[model samples]
Target: MRPDAVVIGVGNPYRRDDGVGPAVVARLRAAGLPGVTLAESDGEACALILLWQQRRLAVLVDAVRIRPPHPGQVHRLVTAWPVPGPLEPDRGSSSTHTVALGDAVRLAGELGRLPARMLVFAIEAADLGYGAGLSPAVERAADKVAAEVAAEVRTWATATADQGP
Candidate 1:
């Protein structure tokens, strides 16, 4: 059976704070949220689209580098399909990926493969250098983001259940 929701963690774990996405996935895995599929990606556009397709809800966690960085600040947004441009305007194409998430989102919109709802949780990074661990602040934020994702999954599950088959 297909999962009701998927959480795609987009980043490279070896790149210090860029690993925030995977870190959150790890937490969710340990928590074991029912009917929630957890996945990690290197922010590849096509891979990302494939991961979330046909799900009722898709949640993505990733790292972003913004000016005057705040190491662990979390930015959350719900994308409107057929997006006009960057997911976050002021941040531009700020994702720490070769092909931005916004690009994948745009492609999904064009292909009409979007999930019923999509949410993004972008964490600010303090370091992107090659390493295995996230910065202290980013580490803490990862825990928080995991909790947030878990809550979201539960809420989605409850709402869907309430609607009945």
Candidate 2:
């Protein structure tokens, strides 16, 4: 069976600041939040669709490249849409991969595999170089995003419990 909610951290740990998503997941897991299923992905769209199928809620954390260069900025948005194409595109993505997070979400929507409520926590990355560690800015943002995502998980869990079986 699917989880009450899933926290998906999407990133490539080998690629410096691109690892923000996985970092966030690490923090969340360390804190041991209840009733939350945590997952890590390479930010692939089709794989994301598989991770979030038939869930009450899904929260995705990833890094994005923003204009004006607000590194470590956290952008949280809703994504449980019935239609496709509303998600932002990856034309400006910093991932080494061609398929970006927004593109992945849209593709999942097109396939009708979205959960009841999906939240996206996209962090503005400071660097995407081939490295082992995240930039200081991105690391700070990861901590912040993890806390926010954890709170959202708790909220979802409480709501589900209230609904009853």
Candidate 3:
């Protein structure tokens, strides 16, 4: 069977690191993988679930605000997100309304609509003000994260191919 998967780059381009996800999609387009479908999202739950239907895997990329160990760190989540508490509303740039990427996955699971496997790439942002440009730090980090996302995609494709019946 052919491998079926989708990579969802989730963010708004004008909002610093929030653009990382979309940027990855653009990079992947240039890389030209044969079997994968790419979708650009605003991290909206409806759009993600719709795009992910029946796919073996879905990779989501976006900007995040992490705590302590590395307040401003780029990170990846390769499995289900740990359950979170009530979401604090965002004052700056985020691509969705009300719910977020993490919550969406959880909600999907609740609704029996979750994908087979899911992964997330989240980069720390220095700023998320109303703007069309990225901070120097976020810009550089996006390039690195995009490479990582591409490598992960290649690995997923290879592994899926190897598991043929």
Per-model TM-score on C-alpha atoms = 0.96, 0.89, 0.81
> Which 10 residues in a row give candidate 1 its minimum summed lDDT?
84-93
Clashes of each: 0, 0, 0
Per-residue lDDT, model 1, residue 45, is 86
**Model 2 Cα lDDT, one tens digit per residue, 37-141:** 899999777888888888878888887876656788777878756545434423454533578665676677677777888888878888888888988888889
Model 3 lDDT tens row, 16-103 = 6667678778888888766888879887788888887677888887776643323235666665534354222133333333566667
- lDDT-based ranking: 1, 2, 3
lDDT, candidate 1, 1-165, per-residue tens:
988799999899999999999999999999998788899999988899899889889999999988878889999989997786688535543889988788899999889889999999999999999989999999999999999999998998999999997
Off by over 4 Å in 2: 82-86, 89-96
Report how far residue 46 has shifted in candidate 1, in Å. 0.8
**Model 1 deviation from native, Cα RMSD in Å:** 1.1
In candidate 1, how many Å is residue 80 off? 0.7
The per-model lDDT (C-alpha) reads 0.90, 0.79, 0.70
- What overall lDDT, based on C-alpha atoms, would model 3 receive against the true structure? 0.70
Model 3 regions more than 4 Å off = 1-3, 67-72, 81-97
Model 3 TM? 0.81
For residue 34, give model 2's deviation from the true position in Å.
Answer: 2.3
